[model samples]
Target: TGLTPWLAWVRGQAPPRRDFNPCGAYRFVRHPVYLSFMGLVWFTPTMTLDQAVLTGVWTVYLFVGSWLKDRRLEHFIGEPYREYERRVPGYPLMLVGPLATKRT
Candidate 1:
């Protein structure tokens, strides 16, 4: 089990952790926990067609957020987290950035 708020604290977003798994079941998703929680909470039962479109756009934004996080983790944690990323497919895992070309 994971704690969204506590993890956020670990990531230095909040002041500190006060409880365990503060966001309940949303701990499963591994990146940008706040964004994920907001999406899960507000994505459905939209009031209008425009709202539905906005929800779709928001989901895309969350996915990109997760991808950027993975890139940062790879840079920071190095090979260990990169291997984790390779093993566990990144959320929405779309390739949006420049390719790593071979170098001399």
Candidate 2:
């Protein structure tokens, strides 16, 4: 986030707090905003060859961005983020796959 609390992490100091539970779409996926952007990039009705190439590049960029974000949050937010990762998928389709939450 590059905010003051995030800056504290860079300085090797504790953040003001570690509470960062996002609501709404976050409940379904760890990176809902990334998923939304991907939808915009991929769901065009007509895809020309150039558009297809652009979409492919953008897809990789978004996927890498989402993964880097997870690593950053894990580094900064620590255990809670790991727990959240366990409970939430990185993307909605993962809800039914290997990283899906285990029932208890």
Question: Cα deviation of 69 in candidate 2 (Å)?
Answer: 0.6
Clashing pairs in 2: none
lDDT of 2 by residue, 8-74 (tens): 9889998677497879989878887888889998999999999999999998888788778888888
Flag clash pairs in model 1: none
Candidate 2's C-alpha runs over 4 A off are: 1-15, 95-104
Q: Provide the RMSD of all predictions against the true structure, rounded to 1 decimal.
A: 9.3, 3.6
Q: Write down the worst ten-residue block by lDDT for model 2.
A: 95-104
Give the whole-model CA lDDT for all candidates, comma-separated: 0.52, 0.80
Best by lDDT: 2
Residue-level lDDT for 28 in candidate 1:
27
Q: Number of clashing pairs, model 2?
A: 0
Question: What lDDT would candidate 2 get against the real structure?
Answer: 0.80
Best by TM-score: 2
Q: Write the per-residue lDDT of candidate 1 for residues 17-89, one digit (tens) a residue.
A: 2332213333323454645665674756646878767767877676667667767866756766554544333
Per-prediction count of colliding residue pairs? 0, 0
